[model samples]
Target: MSSSIEDRLRDAMAARAQAVQDEGPPPPLPLPRRSFLVLHARWTAPIAVAAAIVTLVAGVAVAVRDGVPQRPVAVAPAAALTPPFYVAAIVTDHTVVSKTVTATTSTRAPLGVYDSRTGRRTAELPVLVDSQVAGLGDGRTFFLAGRERKDAPLRFHRITLTPDGKIGGMFALPRRDDLRTETLDALAASPDGLKLAYSVNTRKPGRKGEVRVLDVVAEKVRRWHTDRPGFVDEVTWAGNARTLVFSWQRVEQEIGRETRLLDTSAASRDLLSAKPVTGRTTFFAARPGGSSFLTQEGGGKGIPPLVEFSTTTGQPLRRRIMREWFSPQAFDSSGRVLLGIVRGGGLARLDGERLTLIEMPELPQGERVYLETVW
Candidate 1:
């Protein structure tokens, strides 16, 4: 081989090796205004490209260059009440297993603990299947929801993580039949972490399912059942552990119309009443520190144009069209700290009225990502 050709090959390998390293440390790269504009067309966004992120609420912007997030500019210090802690799930593409090099370092964990204000990745936790994990919030223990195998009954284990992201310890709760093999939304916990609410299948062929709550203090389980045979939507704790809310839909004769994946209808019911709250929606998510909730536009699958609901009442607050798709992910107790992912993809923090996108450098093709609030 010619010496010139050999030199060229060596340089190419060095550049490829350098690309995988984390950029300059400390404050994260902010999304810029120009880059933010591109995400407005997220539905048609090209995979494997750096996303130009915009966070107007916090006055920050991040620019993605060569599939790398670069040129971060801080608009101002984040709000005082904003959530400082959160857990993030990075969904890499399935096909990349053989294409990229796997690192044994801390930043590459599928599950990561991040500081919202500083954009610092504080700890790297176990790399469990995204479907096998149920977020219990930052300071509280998380549920490693899983089963031994496809034939085995579902298992829910409460595991605590230390500051360094090591599993401090884990305990298995009594196995339940209702927990799905991979659906984390099937389980929920109250803000106080004193109670858990879940929906399980019924043995009788003609009966509706049961929504059960386990009180940690008393170590007693309480059960609530629907009048007819139906499926429960999501079981959410309405702040403070004082009220538990859920939605149920009766089984329809037509399986094609009522399929779980396609169903978007919602009928919210609180523990206080048999009737669902009039005009309740499945998109509403309970705020972390309180019973308040936040919702995106419409139901099922579509672009969420705006976020709605009063911070105080958790009721419909206002609706305004968004230039880009922003989906609410998590909120802290103060009801002040809010996290939302762009409708197209990636993470963004809601600053008062403006939004700042968190630039993710390494996204595998066709990756699926979700955020867990860490307050």
Candidate 2:
């Protein structure tokens, strides 16, 4: 019996591979190895009492819903689709900016940009030592964190470059020793380009980690707590300039683990709470208008699939089972998401319904792409 099953599985895989080759690169194989075997076992089960009970229940539910056969609704392709965003290495005379590094390297990461109409690559900005980069639409700015040494002192710099690659202006961040370094996690520019939001991490023994938001425009900051031990995963800027949507984890002695959302607005100075039914949500990328986000629901083995969710409604938007671990890298202005599926020692996009497996291009060997926003 086992031999027969193995033969069938092999045949099925061969057919799929042939289909994909004929059509271009295929999507990741539909099922992982272990999942395919478990599904096969269930299919081979004898028709018995338990199966009858399940069938009866399903039939009743369908029948009671008015005789109209129920079917899952297909989502429409995103309206006003934006051009695909591309990753490129900036050619620069600066030595530090030219060298490339792996995705894991925090220092000297590559800068990513997206144009408005044509969605063309405008200009690649050079990243300096200890410099942090963030985008507000077409304009890209780099921030330099201050150093601890007495002679060097803590300082910050902002590099503004024109679309044609001309240097525009430079500024500095306020310097202070008391300011905690670990507290800083991510920096984001509001869609309008008037304000900036910084995700700061704070850790205290016996208490949950805290991520605070600092309003760069107003020069004010507020602190919030999360039960997650490390830093908050990512800080996403909503379409509306006033609101910021963020995720944090909470550990419960009785319940095991829980994840929650904090919708904060600068106008009201309030943080509203919304709970997602999915477990241990890892936020990847948000839609252009910030109405929704692409998220991964489960981890390890036997978990819920990766999915997209509407931030406003807290509803399950779409789902597909990824046979292996993957992280959402970015979302283009259109609703298409770029995911980094782990294979070997590198990462590449397992394009969904449209594009096929696209190997990320090689930059200077060590260089990495630090994605901020797709738009």
Best by lDDT: 1
Q: What overall lDDT goes with each candidate model?
A: 0.51, 0.47
- In candidate 1, residue 138 scores what lDDT? 52
Per-candidate TM equals: 0.53, 0.49
- Where model 2 places Cα greater than 4 Å from the true spot, the runs are 1-132, 136-178, 203-208, 226-230, 241-243, 249-259, 266-277, 300-305, 321-326, 334-352, 356-375
True-structure lDDT of candidate 1: 0.51
- lDDT for each residue of candidate 2 in 1-375, tens digit (9 for 90 to 100): 476775665566555445434433322222336975676567644333334334344433433345344442334654324333333333222324335642332433455444433434555545432223444333344343334442343344455665553446667655332444344455555555445555444445433445445455665556565444544445666565544556544333423434444555533332224344354566555556666667677555654466776666666678877676666645543334453434332333444643234333333443333333322
The residue-by-residue lDDT of candidate 1 on 261-307, one tens digit each, is: 10011244332234334333434456665534555665545555554
Give the Cα error of residue 17 in candidate 2, in Å. 56
- Give the number of the best model, judged by TM-score: 1
For all candidates, the clash counts are 16, 7
What is residue 285's positional error in candidate 2, in angstroms?
Answer: 1.0
